[model samples]
Target: MNIKDYLESGTLEAFVLGSASAAEADELQQLKVKHPEIGYALDAIEADLEMIAQHMAIMPPPGMLERIEDRIHELKRHPVAERLPDQLRDHGQRSEKDKGQYIEVEGASSHMRIHKIWRWIFAAVFILGKIFLGFAIYFYLENRQAREEVKELKREIRQHHTIIGQQ
Candidate 1:
């Protein structure tokens, strides 16, 4: 098997991308040990992928993860259960209020109300969220500007180094 042909066969790209099958991965590992060029190619591909990811990375909205987790907890708290039929209910044991068509659910409240203290807490959370969002935007722009400045400085330093080395 020609090394160049194997390199261009997309096997290495699949391996680096983690899309290769188990058999293909085992073969790639064996080839990587026998050939230094395969290892170098893998490293270059991985670096390219990392650079691409860094360029495409975006910050999610604040509290997104918290909201998702809260929703998951709420769902867990209110799990779906099979309703008992009217005939299955013990009407003799029911009170005046419980004698209605509605079945009394145990461990789950029918009336849901947030605590009065939570109203204040929610307002505080909203105000703090806005403040944190503003700070995040400010810092993100500052960091981006700093990165550009560092790149410019590094380029100038490389040019000076090359000029000195030529002389």
Candidate 2:
């Protein structure tokens, strides 16, 4: 096999980009060990890809790393287990002081509360939709009537032509 042709076949690029098939990857690995030129070419392709990635990389916003580190520290200080209610941690057993401390949330109300402005907007939209529906129905009926009139006129014209031809 010609090493130059193999190198130029883009197999090295595919392998570096993780698009090479398992068989192709295995073959390339074996060849890399046997051929020093393949190894050098593979290394060169990887380095070029890395350099391109570094050049195209975007810098994170300021204080992003610090915020992430601070959040990690906060989580460490107050772990998730410590945040859980005593009832949950102690298998449904609650202390006397914790009994009436929390309100039992029941999904009793099905109505959703919306802002007054939104309610007015929704009403306006509903009224407009009904008006548009009325206009659409009226136009549809008018169009149907026009089509029927046109058909009748055509029939009359055909009758007049037949009568004239007979004369």
Candidate 3:
């Protein structure tokens, strides 16, 4: 195949973007091995894409790197089980309903795990909630006591008025 025509056909672009079909990728790899020019061209295109990306790069929000590092650390702390890749998944193992679709994989634990910081925060909140509940109950009892005293005072006033009228 003519090198110029192949380059202009956009196969290289498709390959770079990972949109190339398996057959096309095989052909590209073979061509790259046989011809030095194809290899050079692919490298050139990749560099160009990198340059374009650098020029178009936007600054991430502040502390994004810290958040990302925290997440990486979290993932490192609790290692998940290795999954069978999509291509390597056995079709025989899949049910008839799941043949065409992706299947969900179970993790090591069914329960959700949280960060240590969150556990502390949750404990603090729970303790504060209990304290507030205690305060509410105390205030309710005090109010009830005050209401009973007021009723007693009203009864004493009525009894005094009857005594004064009789005299």
Off by over 4 Å in 2: 74-167
The lDDT ranking, best first, is: 2, 3, 1
- Which segments of candidate 3 are over 4 A away from where they belong? 80-167
lDDT of 1 by residue, 10-125 (tens): 99999988899999999988988999999999999999999999999999889889879876776777654434544355544655655656655554546464677999999999
> What is the C-alpha lDDT profile of model 3 across 1-167, one tens digit per residue?
89899988999989998999999999999998888888888899999999999999999989889889876875776554335544345635655666677655555444565787998999999999999999999999999999999999999999999999999
Worst 10 residues of 2 by lDDT: 104-113
True lDDT of residue 74, candidate 1: 65
Number of backbone collisions per candidate, in order?
0, 0, 0
lDDT of 2 by residue, 1-167 (tens): 88889999999999989999999999998898889999888789889989999999999999889879976866786587765656887988888978878744433345344676998999999999999999999999999999999999999999999999999
Clashing pairs in 2: none
**In candidate 3, which residue pairs clash?**
none
Model 1: weakest 10-residue lDDT segment is 79-88
Query: Evaluated with TM-score, which candidate comes out highest?
Result: 3
TM per candidate comes to 0.38, 0.45, 0.46
Question: Could you tell which candidate, 2 or 3, scores higher by TM-score?
Answer: 3
